[model samples]
Target: MQTFRTEIENPVVEKDIIDLANKIELFHKGKIDEEKFRSLRLARGVYGQRQEGVQMIRIKLPYGKVKSNQLRRVSDVSDEYSRGRLHITTRQDIQIHYVDLNRTPELWAELEKDDVTLREACGNTVRNITASELAGIDINEPFDVSPYADAMFRFFLRNPICQEMGRKFKVSFSSSDDDTGLSYMHDLGFIAKIENGVRGFKVMIGGGLGSQPREADVLYDFIPTDKIIPTMEGVVRVFDRYGERKSRAKARMKFLIKDVGLDAFIELVEAEQNAIELKTVAIDADVYPVSKPVSVEAPQVAIKDQKAFELWKSTNLIPQKQDGYVAIGIKVLLGDFYTDKARLLADLVEKYAAGEIRLSLRQNIVIPFVKEDLVPFFYTELEKLGLVEVGYNKAVDITACPGTDTCNLGIASSTGIADELERVLKAEYPQYLTKDDLVIKISGCMNACGQHNMANIGFQGMSVRTPDKLVAPALQVLLGGENLKNGKGAFADKVVKVPSKRGPEALRRILNDFEANANGKTFYEYYQVTGERYFYDLLNDLQDVTNLTQDDFIDWGTNEEYVKEIGVGECAGVVIDLIATLFFESEEKIENATVSFDNKVYSSAIYHAYSSMVNSAKALLIAENKSTNTHAGIISQFDELFVESGKINLGVSFSELIYQINKNAPTEAFASKYIESANLFLDKVRTYRSPKPLKGAK
Candidate 1:
């Protein structure tokens, strides 16, 4: 494990990997708390799997862009550390599961050699920044949003402000007004626009999906490109300070904005402007690397089935703004593919295409910069790898998470049901293969990892009980959700609950009714006309549990009797309230502050110092059994209990000392003074907590 230290070139990343290794050793030795260790590893993209004694590693791919070499690197790592399988996530990240926990640091180091990262892919940090897979090549886009998305991903990867927030933050950039990125469901969303020849974005803030889904509110109709980074920094600072800590359920940014109102949230964000480092960060799109397609003569290939080839082209070929070139979309089944197929696809693109592939938000793959004449050859090559499935982004293409397969929070089997549903779509409802207006998504639980709440037709896993106290896997059917484009969307309404065995029947009835009465209306329009009660009535008969057979007790893709087993979810991470751990974390924050100050990152240094003081105060407050729900609450309570009582005297009140972050601009002088004050405050707090000798006693 120590060999990784010399192999890694970047000192910061090397330190991170080394710290993870040391922490893992401490955890095994029972020195570090399990909750704290979970938080630490999750931020580094090492997640707990459903199976014991193993982990799932998520590889963060910004905007879903992966070079040919990077893909090959991921394949190699998956084969070495995991089970030689790669699972694409709805967030455009690739996850490999079933790896020993002790080997993660080395696995991460191997990935970094190819410029791939896992940092901030999970946990309570800014997650993978996703963009439209069609971003650069979309014909309808005013300009590509890829450069802006890339800049956002780079800026916050290890930023101080969002390192330890109440919950994770999500961001997206849409290619055009079509909202291909689904901006309305993210914490922060940007839509590309060019006003008066100046590039800018239409910004949306405070959106999220889970048990309760909230559509994002528009923060700005138009903000220049230079303002996006600074505005995001301010927003993150506000979320970190005021976001909930005690209750994981209410910790998302959407909940805070809801509780405080959007106007008040905007005010808080505006107040953080002075502490932001760069008020105007100009992103140079010209400097972004553009992939060039290989120049080669078209290869003539014989089409085995002309009809099948035409149908595939109709649904899979994407129109590009660049003339004489097209993009290909490969519909991956249930987002699961093996390393053998991945390597072949990587080689295919590197030889004839742009040497790159973009993973879509729908858990598929997109190959860009292919010459129009080369489609036949590419299709033939992809067909041999079993990647030529029809209905790319259409209704037949379903989106699902690795629910009961690997997630600890799964209540039922999402992937199994998704597989059966796709089979039904192909065998019975063949027309859906050409229909791109409808979407279907499933989730193992209410966390909405598969984005179930935002799909036109959605299913959420659950369990139902009968009169005899027998439990069976069930699904909640939701209807009437759709993205209206340009930062507008709706959440699906829960209509009915049915046994897992009856899921296929529910879908059959719903589709039969829609095909009979929809009459040229989109699924959303048809649902609105029919209403929720109509669908509830249509599938209500499937809810009868009185006559459930033995088959109903078994979840899809499994022969054993289903047991409703759900483990504690680590998506938002756990609250660390241990006094010793809190003090240790405070000292660590001071160290980070000093390092940032040395690196000349004034804003980052100031925030780190602020965090150190807040953490130290929270440590003492926890000792006193006081409330520490928010940073502001900690500061005010510390003043009342400790400062007013004169237990430990700082020159000024705690709030007065800490509030300088928002009051003063982030400069070298303030950063140096703030760090010094934080260190001094830590020393004072330590002395106050220490046992003192009696009067005249040494």
Candidate 2:
């Protein structure tokens, strides 16, 4: 029941924030304060991200769709609170940033005025439930899952069980293979298909987000729509009872399914589903009222401008499963809006567009029902609003998480890096897009806030050093990640670890490599055929440095690693931040961190509870003989975290340590000291955060 303005990262000036939340709880007497509880909703995020001045606010819009008024309110919140920027996420939710700490309560109040809610936006809560954007309009839809998504959203909002679930639960629904929703990578993905002449959902269990993503296992071949609620209750109950509670790393439903087999997990879900009372199912579609239409004039098309209309035709519209209607794709750069512009957009869509508008997963708004004739006029009005940019599906559109700016869990300025990279790419290498879709995604931390693990070429911002001896935030290129419905998680293969400034050029170089080797196919298909090795060799040719002279890096993995991976697809890249950080000056080097050619070093928060991937990345490989007992308190403190790169194995061979030492010229304690200091540095990071793009990265 924390207020919208109050978060773990916000400076708790008075106990008022805490007292207020407790008061809210009392008022509810356990039930959600359906009306005045707007401020108490948004609980999404890890703590490390918000220590910086920047704030991330997630809005819950069920079924990946929203109304014109709701959309306007989102834009108003952006203009009023944030720096007029929104990041449309892979999840259907909208995340706004650059919010002032004091103004957050006001922002929440404003959102409530428009009937918008930020509840269930973060934390271990059931995040905004999502369904295919075309749910209501798509004729192929088995049964509109919008109601189900709506039902779940209403059923769980502020429900204590889901509000503090062991882990975040992402639910997505799609109809058939024209899957706009990435059903495979969700905690629960429901795809509509016909079985036995009955349209029903193929329930999928345990899929999720990460570098180690798992596709959901089928829980039911086809669960009828009526059974959907009961089925979901079963799954939640299973997670509630058996999901790993102690280890955050093992808390996601995917881990539970992986540990106890999908079959057994389904059995648990079935047991729970069987217990739900259908007669008392908690839902009133009329009360929750999703989206309805208003009459509008037929759209007007300008016949005078063929070229403008042609561009509009190419990027503005998408095929609706319905023959008479089409869905318009309105490109939203960084998903931002002004209050006036929001109002105008809403009016424009309401007057000329079919009353329905949807918020796309790409962080853009969609006008679902624009007529064929009004194409040109809509384009003109849209241009007047300055929202007619046609580069969204292209590289100019890069989704980013609000890094160090506001979230307590952030490690770097994810959005800042993404914005810079996207700008550089659009100006420097626009041709890369003409070659084919080169999705460049960026995240602030290992929490995968930006969904970097799902893009074709993703970048997670981290502080890294260059060969020239300077520390700054940089991006690590991930290759070949996509949602494969057949089977397999998207893989973001490890490629080049470069300074953020060089990301654009590196992106261009990689695309050029893809073009030269692509033969004649999409970049993805080419990478699929050529393999990671081909891309690695190309990167080897472009490598700017060959050696490091300091003890600042904690290098992990074998010497012959994939310097740059090709198209190895989802959940690739061995977590090597620790090993990468330890390669510096023997005596003065920073420990548990890596130094680049520029003398910049990278290390993670030692006490970063949310960072399991980076904490013990090197420890998992080095043998017990080489391992120093890290936690030797009066009480036994077994290192609960182990970060092993699936690509590298740390065998019991101290002899192999010889191979690792750039040269064993110094005692191992020399390396150990740096690691110890780095750990302390990490511990301190949790308390302090630089504003997003605040000072220099170093």
Candidate 3:
């Protein structure tokens, strides 16, 4: 494992991998707490899969961009460390499953060799920053948003502020008003816009998709591109300080905004502006690498089936602004593909195109900068690799998560039913192959990893019980959701819950009604006109569980009887209440603060120091059996119990001492003073707890 130290050139990355290796050893030796270890490993992108004793490594790709060499490197790592299979996530990340936990550091080091990383790919950190897959080449875009998305990813990769928040924060960049990046459902969403001849973005805040979906509120009609980074910083700072920490369900930014009005949330965000490191971060789009199409003669090829080729071309070709060039969309069924196809696709794009591919949010692949004349050649090559699926971003192209296949929180077989639905569409509703208006998404549970709640037609995996007390796999059918461009959207209404075995029949019924009565309107319009009650009545017959067959007891992708076994999810990482662990973590936060101070990142250093003080106070509060839920609550309680009560002397209220973070500018003097204050505070808390040994003190 030490060999990676020599191979990795970047010292920071090298230290990260070494730290992960050391932590794993400590965890195995029972030195690190299990919950603490889970948080640490998750922040490093190592996730626990549904299968016991295995891990899922999510490789972060900013804005879904992947160079040919990077793709090849990832494929090699997957082949070496995993089972030669890669799963594309809805966030545009690549996940390889069934990996031994001990080999993760080496696997991560291998990925970083090609400038690919697994850091901040999971856990409470900022997950992958996704963007429009057609960002650079979209004809409708005002300007390429790829550079802005890249800047955001770079600025926050290892930044101290969002490392371990109460829950994860999501960000997205839409290329245009089309909202292809799905801005309406992200925590912070940016849509590229040009107002008054200046490049900027339409900013949205506090939107999210889950069991409870909320549309993002408009923060700004347009803000200059220079303000995006600083604005995001302020938002993250506010969320960290005031967001929920005790209730995992209420930890998302949306809930905070919902609890407090958006106006008040905006006020809090504005309050942090003075403490922000940079008021404006200018992003030079000119420095972003430009993709150039290969200038070679098109290879002559004979089309085996002309009609099939035409249908594929009609559905899969993406129009580019550049003349004589088009991008190809490969509709990856269920988001699962093997490394053999990946490596070959990498080679194909590298030789004939711009040596790059973008992973779509819908878990598909887009090869941009391909010459129009080479479509047939590329089609033939892709056909050999089984990559030429005819329904790219169409009705038949369903998006689903790895439900029951890999995710611990998956309640039903999302992939199995997605497979069956695609087959049904191909056989019965061939016209849907080119129908791009409808979207069908499935999630094994209500977490909406599949974005099921925001699709035109959605299905949520669940279990239903019969009159005889027998449980069977079931799906909740939802209808009428639509993404109405420019940060506006609607969530689907749950119409009915039917047996999983009857899912195909439910789809058939919906499509049959739509085709007969839609009157050439789009799916959204048709759904709006018909209403949820109409769909409920239409699919009500399938909801009957009285005459259940043996097949109803079986889930889609399995042979055994359905036994619902959902494991604890590691989505936001677990909360650790161990007093010793909290104290230990406080020390670690101080160390991080010192490192950030040495690096001259005063804002980050100050936040790290603030976290240390808060953590230390929380430790003492826990010793007193107090509820340390939100940071604000911790500060108030610590002041009441320790400062006012005279248990620990700080000369002032804990709130006044800790609230200096937002009150003062993050200058060197304040950061140095804050670090000293944190150290002093930790010392006082330790001395206070030393004589009175905590009940479960290690």
Model 3 regions more than 4 Å off: 1-6, 692-698
Could you tell me how far off, in angstroms, the CA of residue 614 lies in candidate 3 after the best superposition?
1.0
Tell me the tens digit of each residue's lDDT in model 3 across 1-698: 23345279999898999999988988898878888899999999999999999999999999999999999999999999999999999999999999999999999988888999999999998999999999989999999999999999999999988997889999999999999988899999999999999999999988998878999999989999999999999999888878898889899999999988999988988988878878899999999888877788998999999999998999999999999999999999888999999999998998999999999999999999999999999999999999998999999999999999999999899999999999999999989989999999999999999999999999999999999899999999999999999999999999999999999999999999999999999989998898999988899989999999999999998999999989989887876888788877788888989998998888989999999998999888998999877888899999888889888899888888999998898899999999999999988898898966543333
Model 1: per-residue Cα lDDT over 1-698, one tens digit each: 23336388998898888889988988898878899999999999999998999999999999999999999999999999999999999999999999999999999999999999989999999999999999889999999899999999999999989989989999999989999998899999999989999999999998889999999999989999999999999999999999988888999999999999999999999989978768899999999998889998888999999999999999999999999999999999988999999999999999999999999999999999999999999999999999989999999999998889899999999999999999999999999998999999999999999988899999999999999999999999999889999999989999999999899999999999999999999999999899999998889889999999999999999999999999879786785788778778888899999999999998889999999999989989988898788888889999999999988789889989999999999999999999999999987887777655222112
Supply the TM-score for candidate 3: 0.98
Q: What is the C-alpha RMSD of each candidate to the true structure, in Å?
A: 2.4, 17.3, 1.6
Candidate 1 regions with alpha-carbon error over 4 angstroms: 1-6, 692-698
Residues forming the 10-long window of minimal summed lDDT in candidate 3:
689-698
Which residue pairs clash within candidate 3? none
- Candidate that beats the other on TM-score, 2 or 3, i.e. the better one: 3
* Clashes per candidate, residues 3 or more apart or on different chains: 0, 69, 0
Q: Where does candidate 2 have its weakest 10-residue lDDT segment?
A: 629-638
Residue pairs with colliding backbones in model 1 are: none
| Tens-place lDDT digits, model 2, residues 220-295 | 7776666676677667756754665444567788888888787777666555533343413543435645444444
lDDT of model number 3: 0.92
Candidate 1 lDDT trough over 10 residues, lowest sum? 689-698
